[model samples]
Target: MKINDILTLYDKILIGFVIILSLILLLIPFYYFGSPAEGEELILKVQQGDELIKTVAVADSYDEPIVFEVEGPIGIHTIEVNQGRVRVQEAPADDPLKICEKTGWVDREGPIIVCVPNSLSLWLESTNSDIDGMSW
Candidate 1:
């Protein structure tokens, strides 16, 4: 075919592809991410050497959990806050895995506390906190 005819055919194909792609894109948000809804609260507590540190209210914005690192007389610690519960866990002694420890506490709408070294964790998903998101 002539170059002009070829160009016209290409343009028609491109237009058809764009229309199909646009329809597919419109359906993605509803199926993949869904509607944007308010995140639930996640409360967490860390205890070390007789002192307890509670995390401030963590707002829901990101899908990933909020990570909090604590250092005290007991040693280094990591906390993960998601939904409305806190996951408090002990840091590894040797070749520690801070990220893995943080991932250990993953709850959709509850607390999944884990203290690896101390073998202590308070997981209360149904329980309500004093300040909705405050861990005490």
Candidate 2:
């Protein structure tokens, strides 16, 4: 109605927003940074661009190499995992660089290998690690 009334309403909305934002900030640490449960295992996650493709247990002992075929815009790319290690075994010939295949093997957490042309990526993750680092 009046200018003063509109200003008062705006103040109320601003206070409500501040209160909600503060609550979210206070609760974020508990939800986002909580300690991992006991006996947590290591895992390897595969993705095509932003989409998640697969998750494999990195701690498990595999009898043979696990092959993962990831299809993207370029073509199909192959990823292999064995004995707690992961490698980009093969990529489409057209990709040329083959950087993902050249990345060799990654066993520990925190390393990520990506095939840019294929839009494929892989990362090693571990909930239980001696080093306190960020992984996601």
Candidate 3:
């Protein structure tokens, strides 16, 4: 009935070890996947399927939004880049879901906005040569 009667000394030790291991696993991802956006020279990459369309340095973007159109399988996608952020300003009219437009602005790397209907994608890239894909 009581915890002492139900669990032996070995049982308590095993439970403690599991808790410690669980915490280590939980914290490992946070340590490895830290946000590297700070002071990063972010470059916005626009792509349609496997083809790379264009890349622009976020810092070099003007105060006035830089608008460009990319032709995809479906139609045209208007993308806006400004103030170290980029977004799909307008998706093809054929896209009823308008998922790309709804994705809003991406200010940092890691989060990718995709338009599967149009085969279009946008994401930020860190230009630091020192950083590897996975620093072991």
Candidate 4:
């Protein structure tokens, strides 16, 4: 007859399970995708071909974003750093695919962005790898 009278025990259990599952799904991404802890810092190395050209440091938090330009084999590439994430802000208009510019902000290592046409690339390094022969 009424809402409470019509509902059964299984329906309430299913609703509670769904709510808990939804909460977990919402939080897991922040755990896995978040940048390193505050003050840890991120090191960015911008290279042209095999030669290293610029080294930039990104703080976990900053007042203003840092921008720089690198002269690659073809032309200049603009790099920007905000907070702890770095990205290829601009590449030469003639770039083949603009892959680097589309890479967006990267806060973690291992996902290096490269522009083959310009022979320019940038890589982020983690400060956690301080292993020595003894620790290994």
Highest lDDT: which candidate?
A: 3
Q: What is the lDDT of candidate 4?
A: 0.79
**Candidate 3, superposed: residue stretches over 4 Å from native:** 1-39, 129-136
lDDT of each: 0.51, 0.80, 0.84, 0.79
Tell me the lDDT of candidate 2: 0.80
Model 2, 35-115: lDDT tens per residue?
434586668899887889899886564777788788889888888888878998888988988889899998766678988
If ranked by lDDT, best first, what sequence of candidates would result? Answer: 3, 2, 4, 1
Worst 10 residues of 4 by lDDT: 127-136
Alpha-carbon TM-score of each model against the true structure: 0.36, 0.63, 0.68, 0.66
State, as a TM-score between 0 and 1, how close model 3 is to the true structure.
0.68
Q: Score residue 43 of candidate 3 by CA lDDT.
A: 90
- The residue-by-residue lDDT of candidate 3 on 1-136, one tens digit each, is 7879999999999999999999999999667556554566889998887999899888877667788999877899999998888999999899989999999988866779999999888988888734455423
lDDT of 1 by residue, 56-92 (tens): 5544414666677765434666665666445554465
Pick by lDDT: 2 or 3, better one: 3
TM-score top scorer:
3
lDDT of 3 at 82: 89
